[model samples]
Target: MKNVTVVGLGKIGLPLAAIFANCGHFHVYGADINKLVVDQVNQGISHVNNEPGLDELVAKAHQKKSLEATINTAEAVSKSDIVVVIVPVLTRENGQINYQYIDSAVEEIAKGIKMGTLVTFETTLPAGDTRNRFGKTIEKISGLTMGKDFFLSYSPERVYSNRIIKDLSSYPKVVSGYNKRSLELATDFYKKGLNCEILQVSTLESAEFTKVAECVYRDVNIALANELAIYANNLDINIMEVIKAANSEPYSNIHLPGVGVGGHCIPVYPYFFINNGMHEGLTTLSRKINDSMAEYAVELIEEIIGSLKDKTILILGLSFRGNVKEPTKSSTLLLIEALKERETTVCVDDPLFNPDEISKYGVIPFSNQLADQIDAIILQAYHDEYQKIDFSVFENCSLILDGRNVLNQREIENLGMKYLGIGIK
Candidate 1:
C-alpha cells in the first residue's frame, strides 16, 4: 500500500483520510495542529460537525493499521509517498485572499519531504499560484526542484460539507500537474481512492479554474435567485411556484433563493478569482448582490416588526446551511449581527450547533417554547428539528421568516402566523 499524509483535518481532510483508509489501499496519516481534533481522531472519533460514520471509520482504520493521526506535520510528511495539503485560504475582511495558513502548511511539509515525494495542493486557490508561488517556495526550502527532483500538482477539493462522503465517492475528480509525470501519479492516486472518473487537465491553471468555475457558477445563479426574490416580493407573486412552473421545461434552470449564500465556497471563492489580479469587477458585483441578501432578510424582519421595537428576535440557525453546524463565514451570522445593530434582543436556536457557538456573536440561546416567547422568528437553517416544531408555538401574534424556503406556507399561515419567505410570500 502507498503511504499518504493529509494535512488540515477540518471538514475536508477528515473525510479524505477516512475514504483512503476504508479502501485499505493506502496507509493514510492525518495531521492537524488542533490538539482536540488529533486526540479525537486518535480515539477513532470525528470532530467534524456534519459527516456521518467518520468516528467509526477512523477507529477502524486505526485498528487495521491503515490510518494514523498526528499533531506533528514533519513526521507525517517524511513518511508519506504523497502529501496532500487541504488548508483554508479564506478571503479576509478587505476582500483579499489570505494565504498565511497555506504558506505555513507548505513550510512545515518542506522541512521533511525528500526527492520523489509528490506534493498535491487540494485547497481552492487562485490560478497559477501552485506552479508559480507554492511549488517554488517548497523547492527553495527543501533543496529540491519541482517536476525534476520532486512532483507537484493541484487538485482542489470539490465536495459540500453535508454530503461530503457521497460526493467524494461519486463526483468526478480533476487532476492537473506541473508536468506529465506529476499528472500521471496524482491521477493514479485519486483513481485508487475513488471509483469515479478522473479528468486530467493540461495545466495547473485549468484545474484551478475548474474548481473556481463551479462555485462562481453557483454564486451568479444564486444572485439571480435572490434578485428574483426581491422582484417577486414587489409584485406580490409567489416566486417559488413560478420557479416550479418554469422549471417544468427541462432547458430552464432555476436555483432556490435563501437568506444568503452561506458555507465556505460560494460566499468567499469569487474573491479568490477577483483580487488575485483577475478582473474581479463582475465577481465583486455578484458577491455584493449575494451579500445583500442577509440585509434584505433583516429588512423583511424589520418590516414585520414595524412598530414592535421592544420585541424579541429568535434566530433559528447560526450555521451557514442546514445539516452542518459549521458557522464559518455563514450569512446567517451576518443576519444575526444586523439584528443586533437594530437593538433587538436576539436568541439563536440550532440543534446542530452548541449554544456556546453564538457567544462570539453576542447572541443568547433560547429555551423551551421558543415559538411563544419571541415576537419574530427567523427560520434560518430549516433543520429537521425546526420542521418538527409546531407552528402553534408562535401562535401569539408574530411573524415567521423562512430563510431556507423549507416551510410549508399554507400550514404555517393556517396557525395565525404571518409567513414571509424568500422568493415566496
Candidate 2:
C-alpha cells in the first residue's frame, strides 16, 4: 500500500499505474521493456491515446512526484511493497497459451522481491496457472515459501480500453489469493487503493476463471450479434434497428454489431478458458463467428462496388475499439488484407495513428484525400472526428459501407450518396 510497482506499461497497465499514483497514497513505479514508453511516463506525457482523462491524471501523478517509470523491472520490484504484473499473453502456433513473458516477470520479481510483499497478477491467465505454474515458479526461484515467505494473488483486469479508467474504478473487482494471509492483504490493498467494490474468492483459480468468464460471455453474445447481422443482410433487414427494439425487453440485452471483435481481452482471453472450460463447443463457435466478421465486411464492399480492381477505398479507422490508438487485434488489419488481395486501393484515416504508421502496414496512408472518384469509404471505426466529416461533399465514391453501424442511413441517402451500413438495410 505504501509502494506499488506495476509492470508492463501498456494500455491497461499504464492507466492502472496512474490511478494508483493519482491517489497519492503510494509511490508508484511503472516498469516496461519499451524505453520510449518509460521516458514518456517519466516526462508526464501519456504513451496511450484516445483514453479520456488519462493525460490529466498522468500529469497530476507526475506533479505529485508519486509516480516513476523505469525499464528495470527488478529495481521496481525491489523497492515496492506491492508488485503487480500486467503483461500480454498470446497463443503459440501449437495452440497453447504463451506464458513466456509472465514467467520471465515472476523470475525477475523473485530476484529482488522483499519478504512480506504482496504480489498480484492482473493479466488474464489460464485456469490453474496461478497454483500450478506461477506460484511454484516464484517459490523455486526465490527459495521462499509462497504463503510463509511472501504473498500471492490473482486479480484479473476486467476493463477494456475506451473506458478503462472508469471501468477499473466502477466495476466489481474479483480478487483471490493463495492463502488466507495473502487474501486479506490483497483485499485490504485493493479496497483501500481503488474505487471499486472488491469480491474475494476462495481460491486463486476461481479468480482467474472469473475474468475469463466475463470476457467469454461477451464474446458469445457478440458472436450472436455478428451472426444475426449476417442473417439480416440475407433478409434485407436493419439489424441495428431490430437490436435496439429487442433490447427494450428488460431481460434481453444483445451486444452491438461491429466490423469484428477487437481489443486485448475480448478476442484473446477466450483461449485461456478454451483449453479448460467444460463447455468448449459454444466457445469455439463464437470464435469462428467473430473471426469472420472482417471478411464479411469485405464481401459487402465487393458486392457494392462490383470489381475492386485498381479501386481506392478510404478507410476511416484503425484502432480495435473506436477512439483508441491500440489495435492489438483490430479487425481493420484483416479488412485491409482482404481488400489488398483483391487489388483494391486502401487509404486509411485514423487520427490516433499517423500516415507513417499506416504506411508501415503496407497500406496507403490517409491524406484526407477523399478526392474525386475514389471507389468507396469504409467506416471501419467511428471516431469522434469522423462524425464531423461531411459525406455529401464527396461525389467520387460509389457507396459508403458503415462497418460499425454509426452512420445514419437516411441522412446519407438524403445527401444523394448511396449508403450501405452493417446490419442496416
Best by TM-score: 1
lDDT of 1 by residue, 319-417 (tens): 788778778778777887777777777888878766676666788787776656688888888776876887676656468899888888888788777
Model 2: per-residue Cα lDDT over 144-241, one tens digit each: 88998889999988886778888988998999999999999898888867867998899998999888898999999999998888889899998988
Q: TM-score, each model?
A: 0.96, 0.94
Score candidate 2 by lDDT. 0.85
Worst 10 residues of 2 by lDDT: 366-375
The candidate scoring highest on lDDT is 2
Off by over 4 Å in 1: 278-280, 369-371, 395-397
**Candidate 2 ranges beyond 4 A from true positions:** 92-95, 277-280
Candidate 2, residue 398: how far the Cα is off, in Å? 1.1
